[model samples]
Target chain A: MISKFTYGEAELVTQLQHRNNQAFTYLYDNYSKALYGVISQIVPDRESADDILQEVFINIWRKIETYDISKGRLFTWMLNIARNAAIDKIRSKSYRNELKNQALPDDVSMLGDQFVKSKADETGLKKVLGKLKKEQRELIELSYFQGFTQEEISKGLNIPLGTVKTRMRSALLQLRSMIEQ
Target chain B: MNIKEYISSGIVQSYVMGLASKEEQAEFEQLCLEYPELVAARNIFELSLEKRAFEDTPHPPAFLKEQFINYINQNTTTNQSKVIQMEPAIPLAQSGSGLRWLAVASVIFLLVSSWLAYRFYNETITLKAELQHTKEAQANLGTRLKILEDYEKMVINPNVAVVNLTPMPEKSPASANIYWDSTTSNVYLIIKNMPKLPSDKQYQLWALIDGKPKDLGLFDIKDDHKVMLKMTDTRKAEAFAITVEKRGNTSGPDMDQLQMMGKTQL
Candidate 1:
């Protein structure tokens, strides 16, 4: 019922900072799913991603005053908040400490597995994975999706750190080309 | 300050994927303001990455919206009450912040307004182009209407001689008509049912004066189903006849190929 006219990103963010409930609700309806989607990729667990999602929107409400239009769009800002929060949840002391003793996280590949198993024909992630070389996909998986730093990736994937940076750059550029196509 | 080196150094990628530190993030923002290509690259990465992330929206739980909205309602009400208490603390925060907020708001307002004005200007230009096109089309139609009106007057005039040319007895029932205005010498031919000729062959019109045939020029079949082509404007002709002839170098009418003939009785 509140959907009379939609506002652009800058105006919507301005309204949101002004404590406009309608704008916030519209953002929530439009973006929550996408934000949750990104969160699930990093966190790799639905329940935790949901919790991180709640924290993200609440953080957006609390911290929107700090959002500058020059930095990026509201969506990109929200995305960073979601990614940071999810990464923090995954890389917490306990999670890291437990990784020393356990096998690879069951949920690390859960989202990947779901897409590859049932929705392999889906264009988005599966197609990207298909087009990417094995090493490139692993680099993207580790660096971008799994939230690994260049050093961490070099150590994790047993490649030189300098190689990691160049590969990451090349992989991202390739991803851009693939996305365009 | 080598931008290509800086860009290829992977800081922009780090920034895009939310891996850049605060200093790197600030530097990237500055670079974006300075370099248009960097801004474009940043936009492309931001959009593509966001799109990549957005693809995995496996139907969120139905309860999510209701739960989030309920929390929002509760939080807003609490925040409103807190706003009153925080009024005393606002002065401490308002020192340079108030002016900064005003400046930011004004800049945003100017940018949005100018962009809107540019868009409006573009729309006006488009409309003017469309209007000019319509006027040209109208002028062309007016010219066409004038020609049709002239033809209509010739058809209706008593001074205009109407000659209906019947096909030769040996020929098929192919027919043609001529509206010859002796006053103007405007000879109009309406070929009613001429056989579709070969590409090398053309239909020629001959106006007979004192029993000698003068070439009235050759014509091909027109695409328009009903067309009246103005043939050679001969002032005085005893008769009009259509003959099939080779496209060019026709010395005279081929008597063997006479399709239709009618004499001017007027």
Candidate 2:
């Protein structure tokens, strides 16, 4: 479902703010995959991930008025919303109970295997991210994908708080270099 | 500050990743407004992140798009109907006598609606005023938070010199502190003890450099003393003094009315 309508950032924001359905369709078609990937990383359950993705789009549609261009890119804003919604879903009581009821080791390991298999099927992103040091990659995963605070990352990973920040910076800089290459 | 070092200090990356604290985020944003290079560096990192997000991400099931579009369509239609429902409904008359009765009903309706409209108009005015007041309060809180965060950053900064301004021996006991950032040369003053001045008078700060008194700026004692009040930046200052000068007077400090003086340990 490739959109024939191509829009620059400003133009897309304007059309979405005006509640143009065509622009919205364009937005969904263009960005939904990336957003769904983020959701699935945090939420392993496919059905719940689907629901959260839908919720994220509905939220973006309703809350486009609140998006400030000065802050960051449209994708960054949408990514935050998607991550937050997925995190909230996992944190919810029902989701916790559902997880508890699942056959923990087998189900979780299978899901983890599937996740790795999917990533392995992808192109250079996995390679680029794989090139990062294990600790650096873990820092990025904890902070970016899991929405953990730096302090939380420090505590959970048993790394110093200062080192956590420095490692995250180096990880991103390294990733940036690899991507540019 | 070296913009290059600042950019690579991980503050910008932390900001882009949404991991920076509120104070750091605010400070980064303030710097971005002044330095275009920071914005460019930030954009580079953001673009890289966007690329990572775009490449090799699994697509959501195709049916989700259809569900989303249908949901939006249903919501928009419901919203339109809601707007239509907000308008006044009209009555339909069946016959001549019914029409005559409808005229009476229309007159009553007109009178009642006018009253309700008048009340709603007044209510709107009140609500608008309340909203304006709330906005002002929110703005005030934002400024206060910014100031507090700046003070925290400055106090913790290693290069910031803290100078104590004490009253002259002959004058009543009064003191204040000046936080001078050696790197940025930004000066901030916090009044500790001072007599209230007459409305026509204000306190003026002077930065004494090379035996000359350079006018720093004037400040009001009436301001909340808990927060540091920013003063003019001075690159070189051997000492600092405060005098009770006439309000808005920027002339040389009145040595006769010198209230407090402090020599820098630098």
- State the DockQ of every prediction: 0.23, 0.31
The most accurate candidate by DockQ is: 2
Tell me the tens digit of each residue's lDDT in model 2 across B1-266.
Answer: 78899987777777876777899989998999989999998888788777877777777898999999997787676675563453333223312357677787999999999999999999999999999999999999999899889889999999999998989878878878999987788888887777788999998889988889988888777655543677666777889999989999968888999989888876
Docking class of 2: acceptable
Residue-by-residue lDDT tens digits, candidate 1, A21-53:
888889887888888777766665577777788
Per-residue lDDT of A99 in model 2:
81
Runs in model 1 with CA error above 4 Å?
A: A1-4, A93-127, B2-10, B21-23, B80-266
List of clashing residue pairs for candidate 2: none
DockQ for candidate 2: 0.31
TM-score (all chains, Cα) for each model: 0.51, 0.53
True contacts kept of each: 0.35, 0.55
Looking at candidate 2, what is the lDDT of residue A120? 29
Reference-based lDDT, each prediction: 0.76, 0.79
